[model samples]
Target: MRAVTVLGLEGSANKVGAGLVRDGQVLSNPRFLPGQTARHHRGCVLAVLREALQEAGLEPADVDCVAYTKGPGMGAPLVTVAVVARTLAQLWNKPLLGVNHCVGHIEMGRLITGAQNPTVLYVSGGNTQVIAYSEHRYRIFGETIDIAVGNCLDRFARVLKISNDPSPGYNIEQMAKKGQKLVELPYTVKGMDVSFSGILSHIEEVAHKMLASGECTPEDLCFSLQETLFAMLVEITERAMAHCGSQEALIVGGVGCNMRLQEMMRIMCAERGAKLFATDERFCIDNGAMIAQAGWEMFRTGQVTQLEDSWITQRYRTDEVEVTWRD
Candidate 1:
């Protein structure tokens, strides 16, 4: 059987990455420079697609499938890339696959790390879900009943006008590195799920009050925010491990790039004698490689989405995926 090759596009947010995958191996995975204000994501997506095509030594016509991020992203950016993807699908008359943004992260972790079965901790601006396979579907053991983890971080950064110049997360992480104290913010972890909206407001309020009274600096606030959020994520991941009876864990999504969160997760996993898997910058953030890899697997499983099938959701639950795996 001839191997199927796919050209993947990702424009879920500021970073637009493209890749070429054949039989689940990425021949090329490249991310365009992320946009700061969200206006630049469209052009970045186009440029990255061309970049990936050249890197793969293939043209648009070389692809057997065109896969793109379906939802759980900025509307303008997703629409921009979706239009390009759909047009390519129509022009090439090849199968067009739309992959879920969150699932792509988990699938990419599995691809890069070679983990058989592990709990997934997916944290990003648009999502914060802990997933495990059970019965006939992916069970969402823990999640944000409201705002997401990364979104909380971003919102706090925006409140202070912290430079989005180099990427908001990086800026926050930098500030957090300079931080010296743990301010002890609220950590609301009830059962397996968690909440961040209150934490976000609490941090902002504390920062503003302190700044006004000359009691604290932005770096202090930043450090406190990171501590609060990372603790919340670590709490959920540990609880999920106990809930799912799985020690092996995979941390996926953009927020997984944070050194602070990764460190906490690694230490937590070590305590339990469990292995923790994390992709570097490549698979950690939104990338086309994950989409291509996921598309190939779903393709084999006959999980293709129609052009008129439409987008599922931006806030769709991770547990909704019907499992075809055996325990």
Candidate 2:
């Protein structure tokens, strides 16, 4: 029997990526994100697609199905990718599958780390959730009640006038390393969910005054913010793990690439005698391979999206999909 091959397109946010996955392996994953505009994605998607095919040394005919991110993201980018996937499916006479963005991260984390039903800490620009699989659904145990952790970090970066050449969170991470003092920040964790809006507002209001008064340096603020935020995340994640009786913890999504956050999670996992699973930026950040891998699973389970029902959904929930592939 031939291995199932999938070509995936991802444009759910600022990044636009194309990847080829077959038999649980990523053959090609090329990504580019100049901006978050639908026009930018339209300009880059074709080139990205061509590059992915070239890198994989395959043609569109070799793919068994086409997959694309279906939502919980920006409306325009989701629509753009959906339209492209639908067009490709029609032109190549292949099946089409719409994947949930959060589920893609979880599935990809499991695939790459070989983690079997680990508790997932999914932190990205738009989402923060502690999840675990139960009854065929990736059930959310805890999440951000207000602004997401990554969004908080990004906003803080903007306040500090940090460079976003690579990413705002990454730059903050680098700066935090140079920090020696820990400025006190609000730590909010109510039950299972965390809130960052209050912290962001507090920091933004005091950051300039503190800097001018020499009360604390930017590095100090960065370090303080990271420690407080990551501590809150770790507390909630640990609680979720304990509740689920899970022995493995997997971190996914864009902000999961932060070494500090990973370190904090690793420490928490160690204390509980649980293993920690994390991938580098390629898998942690948004990419096409994650979507393709997810679509591959859905397709194998006899799931496909019909043309009339292939429209984009900006608020698709992770638990909405039936995980027919998992027991």
Candidate 3:
């Protein structure tokens, strides 16, 4: 049998990405995200697609299927990429697969880290969930009740006027290292679920006052925020692992790039004699290669999205997709 090659498109939020994957190997992944708008994605998607194909040194005919992120993201950007994917699928006369964005992150993390059935922590700007696979689906063990942890960090960064060059969360992580004091912040973890909106509100309210009064520096606030939020995430994740009796823990999504978060999680895992699995920014952040990888699994398992059923879903949940590719 020939290797199943897939072309993947991702524009769920700000980033517009294109990538190619053949079987389990990633060929090329190019991304561009200057702004969060359909117009920006529309303008740069084709260029990114061309760049991915060129970098991969493959023609359109080399691909066997077209895959794109179908939901759980910004509406306009998702629709824009879905249109591109649909058009490409029709143009190339190939099958189309619509992948769940969260599943893409989980699948890619598993593929990269070789983590077998690890409990997953999926954290990003728009989502935060503690998940595990069971009964032919990825089940959500815990999740954010309001805004996500990444969003909390980004909003705090904005309050500090931090540069979003790489990402707000990244800048916060860097600043947090120089922090001398850890200011008190609300730690809200209820059962398996966590809440960040109240913490965000509390921090935002005091940040300016603390800075003005020399009570705490921006670095201190960032440190406190990171510690508070990551502790909540780690708490819930550990609970999920204990509940599932899982011995492996995996972290995925954009916020998973934070070394501090990983460090905290590692400590928690080590205490329980469980291994930790994670990826660098290349695979952690939203990228097309992840979508392609998830799509490859689906396509190989005889899953395809008909043209009429290719509509984008902004609120697609993590546990919705059936894990046909996995036993």
Q: What's the TM-score of each model vs. the native?
A: 0.91, 0.99, 0.99
| Residue 293 displacement in candidate 2 (angstroms) | 0.2
- Looking at candidate 1, the ten consecutive residues that score lowest on lDDT are 318-327
lDDT of each model, Cα atoms only?
Answer: 0.81, 0.94, 0.94
TM-score of 2: 0.99
For model 2, what is the C-alpha lDDT against the true structure?
0.94
lDDT of 3 at 6: 92
Model 2 lowest lDDT segment of ten: 33-42
Colliding pairs, model 2: none
Question: What tens-digit string does per-residue lDDT give for candidate 1 at 115-210?
Answer: 768899998878898988778666788889889888888898888998877678889999989988677789898888888999988887778788
How many backbone collisions does model 2 have?
0
- Stretches off by above 4 angstroms in model 1 are 33-44, 212-214, 310-312, 323-327
Ranking of all candidate structures by their TM-score, best first: 2, 3, 1
Judge candidate 1 against the unseen true structure and give its global Cα lDDT, from 0 to 1: 0.81
> 22, model 1: CA deviation in Å?
1.6
lDDT of 2 by residue, 1-327 (tens): 789999989999999999899989999999997664799999999999999999999998899999999998999999988989999999999999999999999999999999998999999999999999999899999999988899999999999999998899999999999999988889999999999999999999999999999999999999999999999999999999999888999999999999999999999999999999999999998999999999999999899999999988898988898898999
